[model samples]
Target: MSFFTRKKQQNSSDASLVLASLGGDRDAFCIIVARYQSLLCSVAYSSVGDVKHSEDIAQETFVEAWKKLETLQDPEKLKSWLCGILRFKVSRYRRKAASQPIEGAEDITEGEDHEAGQIGLEESAIREQEQALLWQTLEQIPANYREPLVLFYREHHSVAHVASALDLSEEVVKQRLSRGRKLLEKAMVTFVEDTLAKSAPSLAFTTSVIAAINLASPPVQAATLGAGAAKAGSLLKWTGLVTLLAAFSGVISAFFGVRAGLAQSRTQRERRSVIVLTSLFFIFAIIFVAGMFGFKHLAAQHIVSPTLLAVISQLWVLGFVFSYLWLTMYLLQKTRNLRAQERIFNPDAFTHPADSPSAKQREFKSNASLFGVPLFHFRFGTPEKNDGPVVGWVAGGDRAYGLLFAWGGIAVAPISVGIVAVGGLSIGAVGIGVLGIGTVGIGFVGFGAAALGYKAYASMSAMGWESAFSGGFSIAKDAAIGSYAFAQQVNNEQAADIVQLALFGQGYLWLLGTIAALVIVPAAWHSREVRRRMKR
Candidate 1:
C-alpha cells in the first residue's frame, strides 16, 4: 500500500482505539498501548540512553495521551504524536539528570548492558538472518541519523511524518536519511570485509546473510537520492565554526575599544566610563556567546522564546548608536575648545580691536556684524554669543534619556515575557514584580545623581560668574551690558558642558548594560574566565 493509504488506515484504527478508550474500554486502551509500546520505548531509549528511564518516559507518554485523548486531531498520526511527547519527556529527564550526582558503578554498567541489549537481536539461523544483518547495520549509524532512518523505514513513515515526529524540517529529515544510508552502507561493507577475513569457516554464511539482508531492505539510497544531502553535516559544522569566530571577534573589538576610550578620559570621568563600558561590553558578549551556542537558531526555530532575542538585538543597536553619537559630540567639542584656547593665548592673531589697526577695525567690525555679532559688541561677547555649546548639551541629554529608556525597556520586557511564556503566569508574575522594583530603584538612583550633579554645576557657575564680574575693570554702560551678556554666555557654555558630561555618563551606562545583557550573561562562566586570562 502507498504511504498515504497506510497512514489513513492507521489513523482509522487509532480513532477507534481513542473512541473505545474514552468510552471506558480498558482493553481498547491496552490494545492501543500495546500497539505503540515498543516504538515509544525505543524513542525514549534513544533520547535518554537508559532503558529503565525510557520505560518511565514511555509510561508517561501513554498517561499523557490517555488524559488528552479528546484533543487528538488525527488518529493515524497518534504514534508520531506519542513519540514526540516521549522525546520531550526524555530531554527533560536528561536535563534534570545532568544536575544530579553521577550514577553508581553498578547502575552505570547495567544501563550500558541494557542499551546494548535493546538493539541486539538473535534471530533463528534459517528464518531471518538477513533482516538481522540489516538491523545491525542500522544500529551502527549515529543516533541523530539513526532515529530518522528507523522512523522512516521501520515505522514506514513519510518524510513529512518523520520531520514532525523529530521536530525537524522535511528537508532535514531527507538529508539525515540520505547521510545515514551512506554511513550504513560503509559500515556494512566494513562488516562484510571483516567477516570474510575471519578465520572461522562460518564467515561465508555471514556474508550471505549480509547480501540477502541488503536485498530485502527497503530502497532508500541516502547518498545519491537527495540534493546537498552528503554535505549537510559539513555545512552545519563549518557554519557553526564561522559564527563562533565572528561573535568572538565582535566581542573582543568592543571590549578593547571601550577600554581605550575610557582610559583617555579625565580622572573624574573614569569611574562612570569604566562602569558603563564594562556593563555594555559584557552584555554584547553574552549575546555573541549565545549566538555561538546556536541559541539564535534555536530561538528562531521556536525551540526557545523569541522575545529574548529581539530585546537583546534592539538594546545593542540603541546602545551602540548612542555611544557613537556621544563620542562624536565629545570630539567635536574638544576640537572647538582647543581652537578657542589657542585664540585666547594668541590674542594678537585674533581680529580684535586691540589686535587690529584703527583703519582695519571698521572692516573687521562690518564682517563681525554680518556674521550676527552686533557692530559695537565687545570681543568677549563672541564667547557668550555662540549657541553650539547649548545645542550640543541639549542633544546629548536627549540621547542619554533615549538610550536609557531603550536599554531599560529591552532588558525589562523580554525577561518579563520570557519568564511568563516559558514558566506560566505565576512564575512570570514574580519576574515582572522583580523587574518593576528594579525599574523604580533605577529611576530613583538616576534622579538622585542628576540632582547632585546639577547642584554642583550651579555652585561652580555662581562662583565663576562672581569672580569674572568682580575682577573686571570699569567700562561704559553699553560695554557693561555686554560684559554681563558675556557672563550669561559663559554660564550657558558651562551648562552645556554639564549636560554633555551627564549624557556621556548615561550613554556609557547604556552601552555597558547592552554588553551585559547581550554578551556576558550568556557566555559560559568558564569562557569568561578564559577571556579574563587572555586579557591579562
Candidate 2:
C-alpha cells in the first residue's frame, strides 16, 4: 500500500474512532491515542516549557480523556478537548513557580563592568603575539517581554492559536507580545550602551571568545591569517620544509657517491664534485639560514608565529649545520690526501687525488702539543696549489698520540678540534666525533638531531645516558619524552597534555621519515640495482 493512501484513510476515520471510543470500544480508544499522541506532546511542550514535564502532561491528558469521553459533546472535537486539559496543567505549573523563592539571582550579572574592561586589555596584551582574534555582535532583544512574546507574525497574529500554543488567554497573548514590541527601543539602547562601554579590539584569547559575541575586529594579525588558518599554514610550511631538507640531503649523499678519497686518488670529477657538493650545501643552507634571518618577502614568512619560529628556527639552523658537516666530511677527505703528500700520515683507507703534477710533493714540517695532545700546524696550500691538506699540525713524534687540534680544522684522527672539527673527540658545526660538541653535534656526547650523549638534547631525536628530550624516538633511563619514548622514572607527560602528544608524534613521524629517506629507500634501490646487475 502507498504511504499517502494509508495516511489519508487514518485521518478520515478519526471522527468515527472518537465515536467508537465514546461508546466504550477499547480498540477505538487505542486508535484515538495513536492518532493524536504526538500532536498533544508538541502542544504540551509549548505550554509547560519542559520536554519531560510535557510528556507527563500528555500522559495525564490521555488518562483524563478516556475517563471523560462521555462528557465530550462533539466527538469530532476530541483533539480540542485534550488540548484544553493541557492548558489547565500548564497554568498550575506557572503558579507553582511564582510561589517559590528565587536563589542566587544576583550572581548571574555580578561584576559586569569589570568583565567589560577585561575584553580590551586582553586584546592589547596579545597584539604583538601570533593570536588572531575577531569578535562578532549579536542581536539584542528585550528580556522583560520575552515570556509574553508568542511567535506573532509567523502565526499571523491569530490570538486563539497563539493562546492555545502558550496555554494563555487570547487577551494575555495579545497584550504581552504587543508590550514587548513597545519596549524594543529601550532594550536596544541599553544593549548598545552596555556593549559600547566594554567593546574594544584589545582582547586576549579567553576574552576574545567572550568579546566575540558582541564587539570584535581582527587583532594585529600575523601573515594576514586568522588563528586557525595560520596554524594550518605553519603546519604545512614546517612539514614541507623538514621533508625537503631530508630529501635534498639524501640526494647530496647519493650523488657524492659515498666513498673515502685521498688527494692523489681524487679524479678531476671528484674535485669538481667538491664544487658541486658545495653548491648543494649552499642550496639547503640558504633556505634554513634565510628562515633564521627572516627573509620576509621570500618563502621564510614563518616568522608570523613565534611558537613556529622557535621550533622551525631549530630546524633550519640544524640544516645549515648539517650542510657544513657534509662539507667538513668531504674536505676532511681532501685534506687527508693532500696532507699525506707533505708528510707520512697513516690512513687505513685512502682516496688518491686527481692526476696532477704531484709525483714530487713538498711536506711542510711543523707540530705543537697542548694538554698532552699534539697539534698539526700548516697553512692552506692555496687555491692553485690546493694540494696541501687543511690540517695545521700532525703528531709524527708518537703516531699513537693523535690530535688534529688548531684554531679550526677537520680531523680524520680519533681526537680533533678546530673552530669547526670532525674526529673521535671533536667540536665544530657538525660534531661527528665520539664525544663532540657543536651547534648540530652527533656522537656519544652530542647535542643535535639524533644526538646521543651523557646529557643530550635534540629537537627531532635524542638518546641520552639516562634521559633525553626529543620530538620523537627517544630513550632514557631517568626520564624521556618523544613521539615514541621509553623512560625509567619521572616522565613530565600526562594523559591529557597536548604538547607532549604533538612532540612525541612529531619526533616519531620525522624519524620514520628520515629512515625512509636515508636507509630504507636507498637500500631498496641498491638491492634492485644489484639484482639487475647479476641478471645482466
Candidate 3:
C-alpha cells in the first residue's frame, strides 16, 4: 500500500500507531511523526518562542519517545506522554544552553539545510524579523493565554485539536482563546495566527526524522534511500555556506564603498573626523551584533525575557540607521560650509554689483557688539543669500546660531528653543543635544512624548540604550521602569538614582554648577555691556 493509504489505516488511533510501531513497523512510526509534528512544535514554541529551537526540541522528543516506547504504560495517552518527553527535553536544552556562552553556540548550519531553500535570503531575513516582533508581542501576554493562542493557530485553527493536544476541555480552550486574542490585540491576533499557521513543520521534517531512525538501525529497504538523502543533505550544507558567503560579500562591498566616499571628502579635517566616526560606527555595530547574540543566548537560557531582547534589537537597528544617516548628512553639511567659507575668503572671485539689493542685504550688524558678533541678531525672512547668517550672543529667527541662547525655526546654541533645536539644553518640537525636552527628543538625556537616548523619560514610546522610564512602552538595555517595560532590570525602583546619575554624574553637581557659571557669568557680563552701551 502507498504511504497515504497506510497513514489512513493507522490514523484511527494513537494506540494502534504505538502498537504497530512497537511491532517493528517503520511506516506506522512515519505516520506518527506526521501526525503530531505541528502539535509538538507548537507546544515547544510556547516554551522556547523560537521556530528552529522549537522544531529541534520536537524532533528530539520524538526520537526519545521512540527509544523509550516500552516505558509508556498507556498507549491511549500517547499525546500526553510525548508532551511529557518534550517538557524534559526543553528543560535540558535550557540548562545546556545556559551553561554555554553565546560564542560557543554558533553552530548555524547543522540540519537547517532543509529550510535554507524555502525562501530567498532577504525575504527570509525580513520574515524572521517580523516573526521576532510577533513573538515579542506574544511574550507580553501571560503564558496560559499565549500557549492556547499559539496552539490554536498551529493546530489548523481548530479548537478541538488544540483542546485534545493540550488535554484541556473544549470550552476552556474557547475561553482562553478569547482572552488571549484580547490580550494580543485585534491587529496582532490576526498576524500571530497567520504566522503560526504558515510556520508549521513541512513534510520534509517527517521524512528527515524517519530517515534518521532508519540510518541508526540500517534498515534493508530504506538504507539506500537514507544514504542518498544523507548525500543530498551534505550538498545542501555546502550550498547554504555559499549563500552565507554571498551575503557576507555584500556587507564587505558596502564597507569599501563607505571608505571610498570618506576618501573623497573636501578637507583633511572633515575626512579624518568622518573616518574616525565611521570606524567608531563599525566598532559599535560589531558590539551591537555581539550584544544581540548575547541577548539571544539569554533568551535561550531563560535568563531574560525574549520580548526584552527583541525590543532592544529593534530599537538598536533604528538608532543605528538614524545615526548613520545623521553622520552622512553632517559630512555633507560640513563640505557645504567649507565651500561657503572659501567664497567668503575670496570675495573678489564672487563679487556682485554694488547697486544690487542681494549684496546690500547680505550683511547685517547690531551696534551693541561683542567679539564682532552682535549681542542680539535676528534674521526674519525667507532662506536666501540676502537673509544672511544669524550669529550673535543671543540670536533669533530662522537658522540662528548663538553664543549663549538661540531661538528660531532651526536654532543651535548653549541653550536653544525652536521648531528643531540643538544645544546643551534644547527644547523644541524636535530637540537633539546633551539634554533634550520636546515632542520628539533624542539626546544623551531626553524627555518627551516620544524619546530615544542613553537615558530617556517619556509619556509614550521611550527607548534607551542604557535606561528608559515611561508610562507607555519603555525599552532599555539596562534599566526600564514603566507600565510596559523591556529590560534586564525592570521596575527596580532606581528611577531617582538613574536620573541623578544622568544629570549630575556621580554627585559632581558642584562641577556642573561651575560649568554652568562659566556660560552664565559670561552671558551676564555681555548683556550688561550691551545695555550700558545702548544707554550711552
lDDT of 1 at 135: 46
For all candidates in order, the CA lDDT equals 0.36, 0.42, 0.60
TM-score, model 1 to reference: 0.25
> What tens-digit string does per-residue lDDT give for candidate 2 at 1-536?
12342243355444444432332233345545655554565455445443345555666666666665545555546667777886787777667656752522232123233434666646544431211111111113343244334234324446676566456788887777677666556535344333322321121322322222213221110121111111111222333344445345444433432321212233344456546654555565456534544522221132243333434544555566666766655655654455444333433222223222341122223445566433543321212234434343352110112444332334445654332445776543455677664435566655544456664455444556665544433456666533334455322222112112233333535643543343224323333332332221
**Model 1, range 1-536, lDDT digits (tens) per residue?**
12342243244456444433432233345556656665676576556544355566777777766655545555556777787787788878877777663653456556556645666433223213443465466567789987776556534447886676667999999999889778867647555334312211132332332333223321111111122112111211222232333345345434543443333222333435445645654554354334423533443245654345433432432343344335434533543454355456655444544322232221112233323433321111111112222111101110111111111111222222111111111011011222121100111111100001111111000112121110111011111110011222121223223222223322434533443343333223213332332221
- Indicate which candidate wins on lDDT: 3
List residue ranges in candidate 1 displaced over 4 A.
Answer: 1-11, 50-52, 67-77, 104-106, 109-144, 152-175, 188-536
Q: Against the true structure, what is every candidate's RMSD?
A: 26.6, 26.3, 24.4
lDDT-superior candidate, 2 or 3: 3
Compared with the true structure, what per-residue lDDT tens digits does model 3 show for residues 1-536? 23343545364566545543443345667778888888888878888777888888898888777766656666667888888999899888778777874632464343233445776666766777777888898888888888888988877779998888788999999999999888876677678878888888998788778777755531111111111111111211222232233234324433542443343333455456556755664564466446545654554345765566557655754565465446544544554465455455654533434212353332345789888879987542113333455789988644679999886546799888654678998765467899875545679987655577998766445688888755445678787644345666543224323423223223333533432343234334433332332221
Task: Show how many residue pairs clash in every candidate, following the order shown.
Answer: 22, 34, 0
Q: Model 3 — TM-score against the truth?
A: 0.39
Query: In model 2, which regions exceed 4 Å deviation?
Result: 1-275, 284-363, 367-376, 382-409, 412-415, 418-425, 470-477, 481-486, 490-536
Q: What is candidate 3's CA lDDT for residue 379?
A: 40
